[model samples]
Target chain A: MIAKVARYILFSLWTVALATFAQAADFSGKAAVDTRFFTEPPIFAQQKDGVAYPSVMIQPEFRHDWGSGNNRLTVIPFARYDSLDKHRTHWDVREFSWLHMQKNWDLLVGVGKVFWGTTESRQLVDIINQSDLIEKFSGEEKLGQPMMNLNLPTDYGHFSLFYLPYFRERTFPSSNGRFLFDPPVRNSEGKLDGFSHWQPSFAGRWSKTFGDWDVGVAHFWGVGREPRLVPSFGQGFTHPPTGLVPIYDLIHQTSIDVQGVLGNWIWKAEAITRSGQGDRFAAAVVGFEYTKYGVFGGSKDVGFLLEYLYDGRSSFAPPTPFNNDIFSGIRVVFNDPQNTEFLFTNTVDLNTHATILGFNASRRLGEKWKIELESRFFANISATKNPFAPPKEILTGMRNDDYIQLRVVRHF
Target chain B: MKLKSLICGVLLMAAFPALAQTDEEKGYAIQAEANRRDNGYIDSMHDAVMTLKNAQGEVSTREFVVKTLEVADDGDKEMGIFHSPADVKGTAVLTFSHGTKPDDQWIYLPSLKRVKRVATVNKSGPFVGSEFAFEDISSWELDKYRYRYLRDEEIDGNDCFVVENYPVYEYSGYTKQIEWLDKKMYQPRKIEFYDRKGALLKTLTFSDYNQYLDRYWRAGKLQMDNVQNGKSTELLRKNYRFKNNFSDRDFTENALKNVR
Candidate 1:
């Protein structure tokens, strides 16, 4: 079914491009490389088997800016590859889409992937969408990550709508196998069943400024999947399945954000709530940021934030063990864009008492080239045994992890 | 006191136009000579300063470099801007060649800088926050405006011919302008501008006409006052070089970034 849909979308796009070839412009290319390291290796002891691995991702993108009289059409085609240790390599076409803009209206339609995250926090709801096979079952767990996708926008506001279909692979087993009672299930028969298609999702965000205040509201619905949760274990089970049961059939997520600047002080606050899933999860975040000119020889902007997240359900999940979580962090940014180093962030998890520190620096080499460097450290301070163990035993008791990344970019 | 009385009596006698046959012919000859000189000298100016002022009494100044390409033996020609402000300063040249459509042009900003090209049709729009637009600044030959001899007048102590000029451009911003041309130098001493609705808009005053090259008369200072806005622009010329060796190659897109 998914293959048929993908083929139809490709054929339609080709037909449109051929009809407009005489008016189309040339093509361009953009590429980037990103590498991330996990401080605490995956804990394998609790899960019986798991692997703690380092990862590297690379993406190459090509786009065409087509001319159509008073209208403009843009098509971006991209491919990505991720190397997780020596045993696993994940690759796929992440984004493919056509965007048309004319006068005051814009229309976008495609079938590859999508992204739906609008906040700085990684825990609450990142909800990036990709095929289960490409992410190594990471999309089912609700782990926030980048993806190629279809998006549409109009002149009404800075808001966009997106739709992403789901795909399945045979390698990663589903986490919901324990719920099924085995009746001498055979491996070949299980492969013939394939994977079930999850429901599509709808999300909308609207933001506007009133006087000195900037206000925004975001809402999301429908049941897709979240990749952050591990499969539950039972007293008796057979073959591991390839997907998990949807956590919430109808999840309604909403958030309200307000930001204002008073003289030299800047204040921002956001309150978010998720309901209609037979479970209620709420998070409130507020922070005050102050920027002073000519401070300590050079100008510096320092900000501190206090955030609290509460989960009425799933308090014992290995990743989130506390019902109430408190986080605080401070960041200092340099005022100058050229010949300046900026950004220092430190965060602490109050319930588990874990801490994460990060620093980033950037400099311009000349008119076209720029260089950037980033480093981060994560430390676990829990006294309890490793409840959250990865799939392999080699990742058990992961304590401290450090990562450093450097990048250089040139503009045309 | 006696010398002042004698001079006043002679001015009064000169002002009275006696119905004599010789005086009428003399007046007609003077008008013809003035018209001939004004037509030739108005086409030769290569650069000038235009100043504009607004309602709040704020002043703005702009310098224009006009290049003329002679097309006929009589010197009727096409003229355009060699330089301007904004990112369009370099290879962005505006030309007004002889055409049914006032003038045509092509501007090239540095492509390497991601700046795009703009055509000449946009010239009818306003010029960078000033009341004068691109069309107003472009060279329009004397014949482009329908002229009528109003009367003899005195401007800045010089005998002048006041002429009302109606623009022949299909879509000009102004309807008419009244000009006072000095009889001796053929330089415009003052000009009153009217909007498309026939409402008085601005008045430009010229002063300090100095001879640059024996026969050429140039205004050292020019001011444009917006009657509606009460603002004006004052222009002062300095270090103007004429007949300098300049060519079309200097205005090409490839040489934009390399120049200045």
Candidate 2:
């Protein structure tokens, strides 16, 4: 069967390669090794701190086009192996999609990906697809989503209309997985409030770029990407795992993003207001980056970044540490033969005084491999004072989860 | 020379109120004439292989393709997609350069699978770990610098006109640049860049010129040597195609992210 499938794929590709003006489809992917060291021991029930072991991932992609660059088909598959945490060992079809292009218009169908946002810290305005939470904590990884998108071009901007037929639940770690709740977070099933499984969601955005300004405003009306968990008491048992249930809420969100560039200065702003997720509330992130090239007359660059983040519902908001905070970061780039860079960031909570600092340094190795060193540390984290800690938030008890990570990626 | 000067005199007289007539203005006129002679190609696309060597003679190479569309009033729109050197094979960069304004750039990372809008602040930094700066690989706009004609000289048995240009844009790492334009072809044969300290830092050489449409000239090879670091980079051109009918839509961030 494997041989037959391989032969079939080769035959199809061979036939398409004969088409007129036909450029061969792109075939590419990567192999990666990711691991983490938990510094301290596990403080929670199922937490095993030390080293989480090495997890290996192999991903492959195939993208093909036909008929005057209008029709296209893409397929990507990912698989990983993990020694520890069963949740970390997984597989996914990141995208298997089709695209059709027309004059000043385009159509996208099947399982694809769409991202919308301008902020570096968080993408609050991107709500079409569910997050692949088990992948990482940075929220940069996403799962494939099924949708039919209609895009129209205008003189001033672009308008995108979306139709998402089904909702996807966020992935989570199992009871044996590392960095999870005491009794595990996943229940037997998902329960969404005021929405059904077959409900079709709708979303749209209008984006354009002026001489110095790039701006976009988007609106989403459907199931919320985030959830509110209702923990069912586990009889207060000491060991045997039992209960936590996630409740999905239907919501309507409207957002806007603006970015302006001037020589060495870049300013950005993202604001959002959402309804149906408790009460109507708003949030905003405003920031700017300034950089100096050839610092000290050398071929090095240093960029300073400052951002202010605020959420209307301070205490009542979700268990995130960024309700009212100041974020500052520094980026150093070595424009050398090795292509090395370092980034350091600090986010400080105004009300709770909880501070988190993250640092990442990356460099190219040889020609194919890239190595990244990352460290995240939390300071002044008080369970009573921290909104992101304990019974209020899933990670409240995980205040001590701060650790260092090293990952190596090889692109083929 | 008499007829050409008479025509130039008549033209300058009709436009006397707009520009000051001086040596600086004469330098600008010379450069503008060369620029206008190279205009109206519509668009172009090409492939390049870049090789770099260090002071110790260690060598590495990268492969990429570029699509550039010339705009009438503004600077050009360019997109570059890497093809080889596995670590950054699928990385792509889109740039929109304006005359005297800062450029807008976006980078697409295949790993994180997204497009990142990069703040174009360190344009003088190296390109792809090579000796060429980011601005060196971009389209040349006439308004970016102030020009002054130095003199005429002979290089490689060919008569050349020398001109010195000082960058007026902010955040540039170079203090000034001197260019040698071949008299017959009006093509840049060599360029010398001075550091911020007014010291000669690097020199660029262009050779193996090929003319498309029998009018526009393009170099098949470009080499930059960093005198300070004793390192060098060479760009060898492979294919050059013109008039591809590219539009603004092809250079947008959306198009950049979706390029397979």
Candidate 3:
């Protein structure tokens, strides 16, 4: 059924392209190369620790405008490789099926990746299936694949639907005979044996602009294949004879966004609620960001944001403790498009006391090429022992990591 | 015969004040005359060039040629021009202007040999490289900006009408402007611009006014200085053809990309 739908979509897009080609002429192309280096050490075990690894990504995009109306065909081919992170080395292609834009209506159908995370605190609905870079670095064969996305606009608001047909499984090795499920067990291949069903997702977003205020509400739902649930002892209740069991069901998520700018102040806030399958566990998060332009000079802009996330249900065993995280960050951007560039961004996690700082400086060498230097710092300052540590020994130490990289990009 | 000659001489003396009165009237009469003169001067102008200077001292000039055609009751108006210097020459058409706020624009690139329409709400935004915006150059008649007589002034030995013009358009980038209009010729001699924050932004001076067709006045040179940026632009008009045999059909979207 999914394949049939994909074929139909491709057919329709081809028809539109042919029709546009018959009426109009258009030419646009852009080529870019981006390279990045990580400062922080690997957060997960079983991954190679790297000090100076470089990655480069190149993407060339092209578009043809058909004069018959506001319709266009766009294709982007991307290639990337990283010596430090081998899993990120891959080739990808994106096709924008048909973009029909009118005065009041906007419709897009395509097979590619779409980013929909609009909030800083609760990035819950950003479920686009991406390659597991961490796993890939460990010599895994799996890679990221394209997904189908559709967006429709209406008078009330917009609606988006996404689907990823293939599902990949993951496993971890532990001390107690390579624990697979909860409580210590022999490691085994996590497979989608009977569940060959494609991962179907849906999101409905509605927004209205009133004067200067924009209010929005969104909801998302997806099927959960593997669910790990641990059993625990409650007040006046004894543990079941059976060991910790796994519970699996579908996941339902909802969120609301409200943003407005008044005078010199910009305010944005988002709240997200998620319900885990089987168990009625929920998580809520809220955040706000403010931006001011031309603070010092006409070329500078500054932004600050504060966010808080409350995990009502913890993933740890037995205790099911609640966790709260607070985050604050500041960003300064210099918008001198002609020459001399400076961009600095710093984000601090107040709860765990973790912070990430980034700095980027670039200068235009000529019309087509530029040289840039960048540095990133990641630090964790939690007082409590590392949660990932074994229960036998108490853990205490701050994790510190930093990286600096330089890149030269030529554009055509 | 002596009594008849004395009566005629008295009538001639009474009518002399109406004919040879001082051009500069003070109190209420001065204000009324200035208003009438300013309106007539503004109504007579059909088109002109607007030049802008940016912070980096870069200069960009745009031509605003307006044509007035007779409509049933109200006059029908149209404007044309190219956006960029590179896009101005042969087989390229990137000129976009509309009569209303939130303008509609079209661009014709010779490379693609096609015209693209741009429909954006913020047409009052700054032009390509200059601080002047499309709203500053488009067909905005004198009636669009409310005027108030500030005081009588003299520019270059010419008595002028110094008036303040406040824009009536919504979301205007300027608060007000002071203009010096030549009293005798009714041509703008100088203008002082104030930003939305009511701070001085720029000053424009017009010179070398030549009478076109004996009845119309056109400025041959214009200079605008950005007070905040310390940059200025000097524009010299050339090859100006007024009331040419151009038709509305020539300015349509289809012809925009093919215009030479």
Candidate 4:
């Protein structure tokens, strides 16, 4: 009850502060209503019924600038309420930072977000923030990380230094959610309390462009965002393996990303080497996207994408489904006033023959509204019951969780 | 006697400049003069409201801010930040134009907080659902086309030089373009684009000319009409500010991400 009161007070204070800033700053936001449909019934009895899940989300962004546009403050707060799954309802501060721009350098402080990679199949080199798995499984959504960032551009390249002061634990579905893991992660409220901590980490990157090529090299000594699942037995839990507790470890990673364009083809590659989680391992993703403009003698463009993913690590390391996979996708853009687009992708595991298919289509409703359709299907998923066979694919738990979702967003 | 004859020949050449010039040479000279007259603004910025109308007469609009920095001995660097079509707000695109080779482009998607390299070979694709193609709006360089002088023409009571420009760049949507250059401003008053099949595809007209910094000529409104599709687009520009002190750093990917 005391914690609830503190949260209420903080919410009120934040609202009051934003109201005050509205008079002099720029304010914008988006509110989205989402509905998802599962193709099959729930695999676990503890999970919610398999059918339609409705949710509503809102994100408000406020930016204030002073001192001749050299000093700036941006705040973005997001919240979602799901009708079916309580754990899926959450809140996050996407970004709240102050940026001070100078002639040769820039400084950013407070909670911020940064992205660093070029591959379309996977972001092997992007490791700044924890993934918001509850929001999406594609790892595109991230929780803001508290950081002190300094960017310097010199004659050689663009250099950026980061001092991350705090770490955010990755969000995961609760036991009653559709995408729950085998042992059900301990992510429910009050179950995973006191899991995140304030640990200082350091990172740096240097990026530059030469002719048609863009290259970036970076090094990070920090807490790894991916956590190890530790079996834990707690009160009111089943025996054998009651729940899995996440354990974040410190790691040292060095990565390089390069992208170049030739004629109609855009090539991208990202490679990373890391240690501290287990034996030192290296991973890489290389791909290219070829675009054909004015296809069918019309104002439509189609692009074909192909990428290969490879990861080398011992069995003791954190499990990943993309150990040896090939990703292929197609993107279509209809050059109409509505700005309609469609994307279809498939990731196939070379060893296990497990494939995941994804499709997304989106179009604008007008100047202020937009609609999107998204679906994901898992095929050829094998069960882990047979220990004699090769270890079951990591995505076995989600074999029955194929879903199609629709979202309508209104921007203000 | 030899010096006298040489002096007479030089004077004759100056008096009748067309006599010594071929069609290509004359066209090149005219374009070079126009380029020279429009140099040294250093940088510029403006807000643009784009209205796209389909064949059925339905219309949609978008708003953005365009910033450009002049690069000596190369094509200009440009950055555009979208403000309207609210879903696309805070999205920015940075382009570095080059000569002979394809331009380098990158787009910053605010929702993803990621910057992705855009393929520049799609120069024929429409820009944001507008009638204007990517090649039409890119920074214009002299070497991108081969010039041929056509007969003089009068447009809206203004004396204009009609010149034919054959695109030297590959994958251009147009076979050739006929540009009517205003003799006084050295700026294009009108342009007619021919499709790859050697048929007229679109016509573009520029109006409301405004001079900035006592040197640069900027058009306040531009209209493009596609003859075959029966669609049109209008680009209305406002708040033409020049010499914004924008440097190379302001046109980089880092700068694009910071464009709120």
Candidate 5:
């Protein structure tokens, strides 16, 4: 195939070019096998869900320094194999970038991923990359974007500019995957496959730290990473929200993230205002984590997290399970050789009387191995008073994807 | 008038740098001299291997690289990037220590691909699951503690100045610390930390001292033993490169974000 030929040519050239700086180059990466088990059959009868499935991922990173340590190059290539969701099996150039440093300015170019936010429960302001939803249900995994970025550090603030040449589309779960609504909405990848998807976008952020407070203000003008749904009712999907189409639109968004620390408490706040999607709307998340270190004279620390999430549109906004919710969690860290940690979170819906419970536990083995256990539980979902649960909409379908996942990771 | 003038001159002579002073002042002067001797090595970078053992005698190892830059007017800036243990690889911590004030610290989580500012108030807490507290690894400043010259004793075949000091920083976990410094090089050989209840909590031993660049001294190995839990962590340092070109920018949050 032509795609194969192009990939071979590109990789060959990249390798030849890298051979020049091979002496100072470093190689690092991780390999992981993840297995997930569904607690029950998916709520959607139209799905071909598997009770248990496995996935494997390999990520390798290469780095080299040049220009007398003033310039650097980094490349990370990643691939994943899935047993159930074929769409989840994918390859990506996670990072292939060169950075040049100057006295007060820095420049970076190529494909990269950047996260911008100061919240734990949700990352409302982190909009650089589209969500890799099929790989992880948390929506935290992202696809790399091709960009040219510049940064300036000053006495007042650190300013950054980004020019993204292409937009990456968000991946969705396959019908074979466990998580879905009564009927999964189709993701139209061909809608903007041509030059329409290559629209250039620009974004900028200014961040400053004063005393105990770290603040950032950002503006993004581009195709929204978050999708807007449009009604396409004639599809074969039988669910009410099922006929919806995921459409990305050009939008303007401004955001602010603030973090303040005092004693044992860290306070985080992130707010975003956006337009040109459906209607101009705002959303915010504020939280605080108070940690008690050396608990009871032991070598462990326990952190208590409390966060409140808000969506200005309330009932009219997109169906996010977290809207008008209060999140409470506890993090326990064991300062042992195993580097063990555990987190348990409970999200209480203020209006819908629903609860989303999540837990993650991780531990490191001798040297190169890590074991992680994670689970998500959707409980007490009466959805009777849910504003977004109008008739047969998809917002009332959180009970379908409760899963427990286990993973073993090996690093080289 | 002559008697008064003579008395005033004698008092001024007593206040001179080389004149007689109290034990407290002598202790401070000694610390200042040691600090002065260790000053002006612009920056340093080193690879480190940390070995940890539990009460059951099980052992584990971690690898990291530490880069530090010396600051003339304030505390030094240091950064540590973890390389091994799989789960925490690529995780980095940046610290900006202050003389007598609380340090500013941030940790970069590779999985999140984000940097989070951390409160350094819990200086006594373990660092990266290691037995070493953040306070233990921070830069040593002359004015961070109040010292007393306990006595001069022989330790490991070397004459050592045994000093007891209490941390001036309010959030420090130790009530006091007893340190044994070799008289010749003024290098710390051993230190014992006391808990808030004044009970012995742990003992730190430093050995295999290596002199780099002819003027700078670094302990090649440091061991911390916790008496309560019967756990210990041993750090072995190697490949020390000093006076490398490093700027203050190298230790800032910006560097943490950009560091490969």
Candidate 6:
């Protein structure tokens, strides 16, 4: 798969280089080396990654604009090599898109990525691309989605329409990966019933700003990015299931996100209604971030974030730990030359008392170098004997996966 | 008795036009005339190279493009797109200033393709690790400051009218600014900033004036020196383009995400 992507990237780059002799173009990228140190040993024997994972990653970007700057082509390709887990080593084309700008509207074609939502805890309204879980368990990274989007600006607001012709499956950690499930998940046996990956999907969004508030309404109908895991028996087995088989379900989702700024306080909310594999469910996340500037008479800022997450789903729906949870975080900004920042977050499940704590900090070493530290800890996660039962506790699988990562990146 | 004498002086000075104007009124008139001369360019853009030098003599450079849409009744809308310091290559910021009110600002992170609203109360903090504070770089609206005439001074052989400006907005990093406005071009030749403690903090010097559309004058180079820290920043504005006919739509948060 990586060889094929490399070939495609080479071909695209050759074509772009040959056609842009009369215009201006530039190339830039970043390379990073990281090491992850797990605080606990592997719980399952299949987790062969051990307590340490070392990896190297690179992303190079090329951009060319011509015809009075109305047309542009951007290509960004990313690759990573992980020594601990082979499945974690992969390659992806993050963005290979062409943008055409006009007076009243603009159109973008090819593979691209888009993000939406206002809440900090969870992005309920963001469904354009599949999550790259193998890259980061926090689900902040995403794969580029093949799409054609048209954006229109009017007096009322901005409207965007998308025709996504290809669907990308969510990446998952293998059994040998550190953060694996009890029974592990098999991605090769994915079942797509109503549609194939080639089938097209549709999505639209309308966004506007009124005074201090920003609002967006969007709807998506297609193959769901998330898969419902179904237990599957081995070839010779009978009763006990061997592993979980991911089943892609067709879904329809409508969501809205809103954010308002009042002085030093920013209020954010995201709500979504989705239906597909199980009964229709509604989810919401509401939060506020307040910042205190010039802390202690110094050029520093301290911000506090508090959010509430709620999910209304039946027993047959996908298992989730955030059904009823509260998330709180503290952020500090040094406001210095390096733009140093630190953020610590905690999410607590109201019913089970399970908690997930995260810490992330980053600072620039110089003009082209940066260092980042990130860690996640799980606590009070109670394991259930029957993992396949209804209303399973999902957080138990990652109970012993607390890890700290240190990454040093160099940009060119 | 002071009030009676002042009233009599005012009434008598009305017959003599030169004696009728007070220091505050004269300062305001000079600034208003300068502001009127720079009012007609609908929009403008320029590329800037900012070099920052620390007290240890270590230097770093940053490059960005800035565009501004002039508003008649309110503050201007500004957008900045970073180019160099490769890590922040595609990052952009959109700002809508409302003079005395809190400005609306948003920053776009290209890696996540996210546009996040930022708090606007940090006016005293440095901008991008530069000696210039956020308040110093923002659009200079007339209502944002109250003016008082000081004394005349000559900077680089140019006769300049000295004036003191006190920030009208709350939470300012400076107690006051002393500006040496060039008498000929109606542009500032030098500015001295006083910290909140009423001590000298930073000094800004402007040179290389260029006129656009035969009316508006823009500074081609600016250098800010921090007296307390011995740090300084030099900003070189290049490739100035004016009258671009940009509208509010081009400066929106949505536009920031698509900046290349």
DockQ of each: 0.02, 0.51, 0.06, 0.79, 0.70, 0.66
List model 6 lDDT by residue over A1-412, tens digit each: 9999999999999988767732566788899999999999776777874677889999988888888889988889999999877778999999999999988999999999999988898867899989898998767799999999999998899999999999888888887887766567788888786788898889999999887899999999998887887778775454556677778878899999999898889999999999986899999999999999878557778999999999997665555678999999999988777879999999999998899999999998889999999999999988757644522667666889999999999999
Q: Write the per-residue lDDT of candidate 4 for residues B104-147, one digit (tens) a residue.
A: 99999998888888889888899999999999988888888889
- Tens digits of per-residue lDDT, candidate 4, A45-136, equal 88887599999999999899989999999999999999877767999999999999998999999999999999988878999988998998
User: Local error of candidate 1 at A301, Å?
Assistant: 4.6
**lDDT of each candidate versus the true structure:** 0.46, 0.80, 0.49, 0.88, 0.82, 0.88
Worst 10 residues of 6 chain A by lDDT: A384-393
lDDT of 3 by residue, B1-260 (tens): 99998988778768775343443322224344544443322222243454555566554454443433222222233434432232232233233233233333444544333343332333334343344454554544433466666778888899988877777655466798888878777768998889878999878788988876556666787787778877666665554455544444344443342233
Superior candidate under lDDT, 1 versus 5: 5
Interface RMSD of every predicted model, in angstroms: 17.1, 2.1, 10.5, 1.0, 1.4, 1.1
Q: Candidate 4's error at A309, in angstroms?
A: 0.7
**Better by DockQ, candidate 6 or 1:** 6
Best by DockQ: 4
User: Residue A32 lDDT in model 3?
Assistant: 38
Write the residue-wise lDDT of candidate 5 on B1-260 in tens digits: 99999998898877885455666776776777789879989999999999888899988888899999998889998999988776677899988888787788889988778989898888888876777888898989988999887778999898988888889986788999998988888889999999888999889999999988887889999999989789899999999998778886677776787665
User: Which model scores highest in lDDT?
Assistant: 4
Candidate 3 chain B least-lDDT 10 residues: B68-77
Q: How well is candidate 1 docked (DockQ)?
A: 0.02
Which 10-residue span in candidate 2 chain A carries the lowest summed lDDT?
A384-393
* TM-score of candidate 3 against the unseen true structure: 0.56
For model 5, what is the alpha-carbon lDDT of residue B134? 80
Would you give me the overall lDDT of model 5? 0.82
Model 5 residue A182 lDDT?
35
What does the lDDT read for residue B226 in candidate 3?
73
- List where candidate 5 sits over 4 angstroms from the true fold: A1-24, A189-195, A235-242, A314-318, A382-394, B1-20, B212-214
The residue pairs in collision within model 3 are A24-A67, A39-A402, A39-A403, B93-B108
Tens digits of per-residue lDDT for model 2, A1-412: 9999999999888887646323576777788887877665555566555565778999887778889888988788888887667876888888888899876888999887888876667677778888887787656688888899998777778898999998887777666555565335774555787678677889999988886788889999988877765555455544343545667877789999888877777888899998876678999999988887777557788989899988874333344557888999999998766678999999888887778789999998877888998888777765534322335434544467677888898877
